[model samples]
Target: MMKEISLEGKTALVTGGASGIGYAIASEMIDAGAEVVIVGRRADKLQEATEKLGDRCRWYQFDVTHVDEYDQLLNQVDEKSPVDILVNNAGINIKKDFFDFRAEEFDRIVETQAKAPFMLSQAVAERMKERKSGNIIFISSLATILGMHEIQAYTVCKSGVKGLARSLARDLGPYGIRVNSLNPGFVYTDMLEKTNLKTPERLKEIEEKTPLKGFTQAKDLGMAAVFLASDAARFITGIDLVVDGGISSSFLI
Candidate 1:
C-alpha cells in the first residue's frame, strides 16, 4: 500500500474541538504529526481535550459565535507558522418540531455553522491564498439533503455549508487553496450516546436504513478529515464526500 496521506509539517485548527467529532479530528491530526489547536467555548473541556491529545495539541477558548474575535484569531495563533489546514466542525442542533422552531434557534445554528465558518475561512484563506496552498473542510450533516422531523435549523445551516464549499472552492481554486465539505451521516459520538440510543431495536432500525448496516464512527470521520487535509487530496477540491452507509435518502427521495 502506498502512503499518500501525511501531515508531517501541517498545522490544523479545529473549532468545537473539545469533544465529539471535533476532538476526534484534532486527535487524528495530532497522531499524524500535525500541530493541532482545538478551540471551544468551554475552558474545562478545552483543557481536557488538550490533555487527552498531549503535546502536539493545544487548546484555545473562544466562542465560534464571537464574531468579534475571529478576524484576528488565526493570525494570533499562527503568527509565525501559517495554518495549513482549517476544519470548521463547530455546530449546534436543536431537536424540535418545525413549527416549534423559533427564529432565535435558526439564527444560532446559522451563526455557528454557516457564518462563523464563512468568516473564519476568509480569515485563514487570506494566508493560504497568499502562500498558495491550504485546505478547508467543513463537517456537514445528512439532514442537509433530507427532511427530518426535528433539527430543521441544523439542516438548513449545513445546507449552507455545502453551498459555501462549492463557491469557495471555485473562488479559492485560483489561489491554490482547496475548499471542501465532508458529510457524515449518523456518526456515533459521545454526544449521540447521550441520546440513549443503546436500544437494540433502534440500532437495528439504523442499520437497516443504512446500506452498510452500521453507524459511522467518529474515528472514521477523523481519518477522513486528515486525508482531505493531506497532500493526497491535492487534486481534489470543491467536492462533498458523503460518509454515510449509502442509504442515499437524498437521492431516493
Candidate 2:
C-alpha cells in the first residue's frame, strides 16, 4: 500500500505566496491540510489570497529581501503557530544581454532569490532544531540546467539555490530537517507571460521543445511541493526535483 500523503498538522510559510506559483503552492498545501502563511510585499495581494485560501490561511506583508526583518516576521508568525515548512519561492528576473547587465541588477536578483532564502532558512532552522524536525523547499529554475539567454542573474542565483539546498540538507539532516529544491520548467504564470511568453512564436517554441508538448502549470509545482513537504517524502533530501514535464531531457533534432 502507498503511504498516505498528508500535512495535517504542518504550518507552511511561503514567500511570494500572493500570486502565481507561490499562491498555487499555498492553495495546494491548504488542500493537503496544512495551514499556510502567505508572505509578500503587497498588502492587497496578501488580503485577497488570504480570503481565497479560507480560515486555514494567513497573510504577512513583508519583503523577504529585507534580511534583518526576518526574525521579527518569524516571531509574529511563531506566536500564532510555529513554521513547519518554508518555501523560498519569491524571485525576480531582469532580461537583458549579458554584456548589458549591471552589477547592481545582478546583486538585486541574488539578494532576493539567493540571499533571502539562505537567511530565512537559517532563522527558521534554528526553531526547527529545537524541535528536531522541519522541511525547506527552494524554488529553483530549469534555467540553471538549460542554456537560457538574457537571464544570467536569475539563472546564477537559482543555481546557487540548489547548492544552498544540498549544503543545508547535509547540515540539517542530523536534526531531521530536509532541504530540497524544485526546478520548474516553462511554467505559465504572470511573470512568464510578461517575460518569456511574450510572443506566440516563443510560446509555440517552448511547447514544441518540451517532451510533453505543453507548459507546466503553477499547480503542477504546487502538487510536487505538497509531496515534498508531506511525510510521503520524509526520506528525501539534498536533491533537486525537476517538475518540468520532461523538457529538461528533450533535445532538438
Candidate 3:
C-alpha cells in the first residue's frame, strides 16, 4: 500500500495563493484531500484561481503586509473553520544593488517577506495553539543559501523568514504545532521568467549549474509542501526542506 499522505478533514490557508508557487501548493493541498483557502491581494486573480481549483477551494483577498488586518482575517476564516495548516508564502522582491536600495525599498521588502509571514504565522499559531495542533509551512528561497548578485533585500527577508521558522519550531513544538521552512531554488514561474533568468541561454546556465541538471518546477515545491503539511512529517520540525534540485549543495570544480 502507498504510504498515506492524505490531509483529509484538514483546512489550509495559503497566502499569495492566487498564482505561482502559492497556487501550486494550494493545488497540492487540495489533491491531498484538504479544503484550501487562497489568500491574495488581487480579487480577480483569486476568483479565477478559486474557480479553476474547484469546490474544495475558496478565496480571500487581503494584503498580507497589513499586519493589523491579520486578526480580522483569521477571525473570519476561523468562523468558517479553524485553519489547520498555514502556508506563509506571500512575498515580494526588488532586484537592486545594495548601494541603490532606498529606505522605502528596504522596508517594503522586509514588510512583505519577513514581517508579513511573521505576523500571519503568529496569528494562525494562536488559533493552532488553542486547538493544540497545526502545521506552519514557510516558503523561503535559495537566496539565503547562494550568494546571487544584487537582491540584497530579497536575501535579507528570505534569511529572516528561515530564522523565524526555526524559532517558531522551537517555541511551538511543545504545543504540538510544527513549523518548518521550504526553501525553493530557481523555480521557473512567471515572476521568474520576468527576471534575468528569462532567456533560453540564461535558463541553460541554471541547468548546467544545478546538480540535478535542471531548474525546479513549481509542482515540485507544491508536492514538498503537501508532505510537510501532512502527518507523514509529524516528527519533522525546525528544518529547512530544500527543494532546489541539489543546486545549493553543488560547487564548481
Candidate 4:
C-alpha cells in the first residue's frame, strides 16, 4: 500500500482491540506507519493479537468499564508515548427487549460504550490541547440510524457516542483536536457470530437489504478509521462516517 494517509510519526491507542473491529483498526494504523497500542480485557487475547501484529503493535489488558483504572492506564501509555490518535472503540451489547433489560445490564453497557469514551476523550483531549494536535475516533453503530430490535441499550449507547463526538469536536476544535464517529453496519466478526443475526436466514435478510449485498468487513472499517485519523481528514470533525453498505439509505416501505 502507498499509505497515502501516512501517520509515520504518530502513536495510537485503540480500546477493545484484541479482536473484531478493534484489531482491524490497529492493524490499519500500523500499516499507515503509526505505532499502535491495543487495549482489551483478556490478557491471552491481547498477547495473541500483539504477536500477530508484530513489533509496531503493543497490547494493554484493561477493561474500559473499570472507571477507577482510567488514570492509571492513561499514565502508563503516556509514559511510553503521548497518544496522537485515540480510538474509543470499546463496547458491549446485550440482546434483550427494553422491558426485559435489567438496570445493571444497561449500566454495564453504558459504562463501557458511553462513559468510558467520555473519560478517555477528556483525558486525551486535555493532553492533545497542550500539544495542539490529536485525533479521536469513536466506533458507533448503524442502529443509531435504524433502530434494531432487542438491543435497546446498545442502540442508546451508540447514539450517545455520536452525540459525544459532535460535542467534543465543538469543545476541542479550537485546541487543534478533531473528533469524529464512524458508524458501522453489520460486520462479520466473532462478535457477530454470537448475536441473533448469526443464523443463516437472518444473515440472508441483512444481505438482501444491504444495497452492497454483503456484510461489511473488519478491514473496511479499519480503512475508514485510518482516513479519519490521518491528515487527509484534518478539516473534518464532528461528523458521522457511516460505513453501512447503503443499509441506512434503504426503505423497505
Candidate 2: regions farther than 4 A off: 1-3
Task: Give a tens-digit lDDT track for model 2, residues 122-174.
Answer: 99999999999999999989888888878888988998999999999999999
Candidate 3 per-residue lDDT over residues 5-60, each given as its tens digit: 99888999999999999999999999999999999889999999999999999988
Tens-digit lDDT track for model 4 on 1-253? 3455898989999999989999999999999999999998899999999999999998888988777787888889888898999999888788977788899998888888889999888877878899999999999888888867788888888999899899989999999999999988889887667765767998889889899898889999999999999988989999999998898999940
Estimate every model's Cα lDDT from 0 to 1. 0.83, 0.92, 0.89, 0.89
The TM-score obtained by model 1 is 0.92
Tell me each candidate's TM-score: 0.92, 0.97, 0.96, 0.96
lDDT of 1 by residue, 173-222 (tens): 99999989998877777655544255778767777778777888888889
Clashing pairs in 1: none
Q: What is the TM-score ranking, best to worst? A: 2, 3, 4, 1
Best by lDDT: 2
Error of 4 at 248 (Å): 0.7
lDDT of model 4 at residue 79?
86
Residues forming the 10-long window of minimal summed lDDT in candidate 4:
190-199
Clash pairs for candidate 4? none
Per-structure clash totals for the candidates: 0, 0, 0, 0
